[model samples]
Target: MMGFPQLSLVPLVGLQYLTHSSTLLSSPWPLASGLQQMGISQGDVVLLLLPNSIYYPIAFLGVLYLGAIVTSMNPLSSVAEIKKQIADTKACHAFTGPENADKLQALGIPAILVPENALSGSLKDIFSVFYKLIYSRCYLALRPVIKQRDTAAIMYSSGTTGVSKGVMITHRNFIATVAHFVRFEASQYEGSSLDNVYLAVLPLFHIYGLSLFVMGLLSLGSRVVVMKRFDVNEVIKAIDRYKVTHFPVVPPVLTALTKRANDSLAPHSLKSLKQVSCGAALLSMKTIEDFVQTFPHIDLIQGYGMTETTAVGTRGFNTEKLRKPSSIGLLAPNMQAKVVDWNTRSPLPPTSTGELWLHGPGIMKGYLNNAKATLSTIDEEGWLHTGDIVFFDEDGYLHLQDRLKDAIK
Candidate 1:
């Protein structure tokens, strides 16, 4: 790790306007000190219910530095869902926005209320004073070291099928996915200033918006504009206001963007956008074509992956490739993929539809607190059973059919 670029230093590189909590700069020391004061320690699960507020980054990284596993819940989660997640993870402490703070506390769980105006005068002043003391020691020779396979975050999927299960994303898995994305950017945005602002309207709780897009962008030094929730009009307004260049979204968002273009609520100067990436759900060929026709100059690419696979397993969609828009491109570099029979686990030949199995560092450790589920998902050799039915073409491009789990018997 000596010569590797420090991911923490990336955001400070080229930022005319990067706005996170005042405490974001309080990392490596103030964070340690604050958590020490709060009594959070390694291996503890901390439930976080913060909005897209600046406080979110501060609280999240603070917990991470303490060796505690952070579980971020959807801000819009119902009271029942919130209660279930807290119980499931058995979190010792919680940090949340005012909206969900009292409700969570009512469950007899301890919590710290992140003030509505946490960025205001008094808090900002306090953070500034602490920031100076922490930085003065040059981080006081902080010897923080995170192991590659240590559990970093316990993420839960949307559970469209059933109760959400915690997905265990290790530091190694995340770093590998980051490495994969860096390889994908080889010539696409090469030599371009990473100072460009990124508009992030996607929910950070989701794998697509959280690990793949936000962390990846921050690791490379780009300003992030986070929207608390997805509002089609607000998203457009933010893009224009912030002059965002790269936009990452889901299918529903892509639809709204096309419908809202050139409208009064839409950004007047959205022509500044360089490219947009869509994931989380299958994007239709008509939607892709319509988007290209509407924006004309913008490059739109569809990426595919599941939470178990650490966000994106593949990314490849160019003009020639769009002839078969169903394909999610090729497996990412360092990723070895094969189609296997769902029943016998026997390897299937290419162009034969079967379950997609992935072997890569980006695959999760397993489902948290569920050994049976873990065994069902990850084999002895560490291949992840994606539960998604897909096949490879003669060109080696992967085309997804439907989810084996989602398919009705």
Candidate 2:
């Protein structure tokens, strides 16, 4: 890949403050050397419990460079929940934000807190031991020759249904997902450099943020502005300040944005935005209509995926097939999808509602350490039985019915 753009993280506190982003190429070796010295070997699982920050990406890449698995945890998770997950994953080392470090340490895990960016620009402000290693140069520390099938990440599913499960996403899974974005940008965004300013407000611990926004944007060398936390006013101001071109968000954020934009006293200044992608929870048709009516220039697209499908499975794309807010767009390239009856397990036709099953290279390796769950999720035929029930319109656009796990029989 070519050299990525010079990245700068615009802090939420002020528009003037900017933090330099250390790319995958130059920063990984030093950090990898440090990790090697710390006894982090290949295939060892490490937990990155952090909020959205420049340091999180660097630490994640460093672990991957050494052929180790990086399992990201929620920074806001309660102590009891964090303990259960750590024990479940068997991760001995954890890198966390300053806010969550103390709690993690109390649980007997080797937790390192990410340091503040002091004015001196010296290593004194950064994470003490971690920054020291970033300066260390060791040729032997580079161990990038990792098998594709090896587990690269253990992503925890958003437990909207019942219980949280750790999903094992492999290196090939990430590579395939990124490759799709690269190809899509090159072909669709022909005149443009495919490099635009990205608002990194989405939590990186989640697969939606990690696989697509973080990994995808970095691959293109786009500038990302990190928000410590999301506030409706702060987001609007950021868009106006950074001229954010693309925003991948959840449904709630969109709903809030629409409400704010409708306020006549404070008009929205989101002219630079080309598109806004939403998923996680189903967005109401009314919200989509209101947002579109308010900002006719912006393309509001919808998508559907899970922690199991890397990040993307079906997403709305360019051309005349646009503006279907109710639909989850189309199946991704090289992706096979089928809709089957809930009880009888018989295939359903287009326009008939049934469970959405998908087979693709983007499917996760499996649920980490849970073979029964994995087998039940992905059958012997390799099709992942997504609990979501959906149907297609006459135009072949997929629309949701409801999630079988949560739907009343």
Predicted structure with the largest TM-score when compared to the true one: 2
Clashing pairs in 1: none
Residue 4 accuracy (lDDT) in model 1: 13
Candidate 1 is scored at a TM of: 0.84
Backbone clash count, each prediction separately: 0, 0
RMSD in Å for model 1 = 5.0
Lowest lDDT 10-residue stretch of candidate 1: 1-10
lDDT string for model 2 (1-409, tens) is 5435444445666644354444335666777777777888888889998887766667787778788889887788999988888888888798887788789779888876674332345546546666666656664444567998989988888423456889899988888777653345434654454457778778888987886555776777676767767888888888888888878889888888888888742445888888888877787778888888888888777877778888657787546544577788877777789999989999988899998898988888888778878888899999998888899877778898788976756
List the global CA lDDT of all models.
0.69, 0.76
The true-versus-predicted C-alpha distance at residue 142 of model 1, in Å, is: 8.6
List model 1 lDDT by residue over 1-409, tens digit each: 1111111211122222334323345454565556555566777888877665434555666677767788888777898888888888888888776577678878887776663233455665534533443344333234456798899889996322455799988878778766785435533554543556677667666777776434566556556776666777666667776677778888898998888773544335687787787777788878888887788777776677778878758875566444444567767878889998878879999899898888888888888788888887788999877778889999788887888877637
